[model samples]
Target: MQQSEALCPKFEFAFSILSRKWTGLIIQTLLPGPKRFREIADMIPNMSDRMLSERLKELEGEGIVMRTVYPDIPVRIEYALTEKGKSLESVMREVQKWAQQWVDC
Candidate 1:
């Protein structure tokens, strides 16, 4: 086995995705339900629209987020967690609980 993969393959893979900026938060936001692109963007302070779009696309590529478009005059689009994405809820909540207990902020 490769040295890095042997050490902690699962963790390495999970962290590679979760550690990206705004990724965890995006997952958290989607836990409630699907939301529009703008709604997700608004949840995070100081996050640029461009960045949000980029992150959403990245998550979609990973099969963690699904994008749906409605046929409307304005072309409304929304983002939601797929079954794969919803799988991370427990992990995220565990992290939140850990942060609550240990994080200074």
Candidate 2:
């Protein structure tokens, strides 16, 4: 590791979180608006219900995602981004732009 990377632990920390599997995708999915658990799952192809649930919990714990529960027959739940999470929108957009330029699909 470079000396600068070692010195700037915050960058490393942020990169670690964003680099995790599905973290970026989850954030991207929530960028539009709040959504039900199933809605998120359906948006991301090949995402398991279990993995989605786990990532949501982790994001919630980090204050990046907000989970709301409504009282109903079976129970209704929705997940949305908090202010902190919304702050990442620009970053996500930049990534998307970069991917478009450099990655061939």
Candidate 3:
């Protein structure tokens, strides 16, 4: 019998981000385009504002999400995928396809 090698560091790192609660959904939500914080909260039902805020910060730190602040009567903010984040579109789509086919929930 052959022993399996340890997971690649890059793969491990990627999973570390993806495996976080609400991370993938947040990424998916932003895939189409930029959105305000409230928009994201609405799209992903049941995710608390605090959790979403934390996850967005994590993603921003990861260079996956870019947060933009607009100056206006009320300072508006929006979150969008960076080029690095946009790169995950194919991966996310593939996961969605798999989930549709095999995920029971």
Q: Each model's C-alpha lDDT?
A: 0.94, 0.93, 0.94
lDDT of 1 by residue, 31-95 (tens): 99999988888899788889899999999999999999999987999899999999999999999
Tens-place lDDT digits, model 2, residues 24-86: 999999999999998999989888999999999999999999999999979999899999999
Q: Between 1 and 3, whose lDDT is larger?
A: 3
lDDT of 3 by residue, 27-98 (tens): 999999999999999999989999999999999999999999999769999999999999999989999999
The clash count for each model shown is 0, 0, 0
Which candidate comes out best when scored by lDDT? Answer: 3
TM-score for candidate 3: 0.92
Task: List pairs with backbone clashes in candidate 3.
Answer: none
Total backbone collisions, model 1? 0
RMSD of 1: 2.6
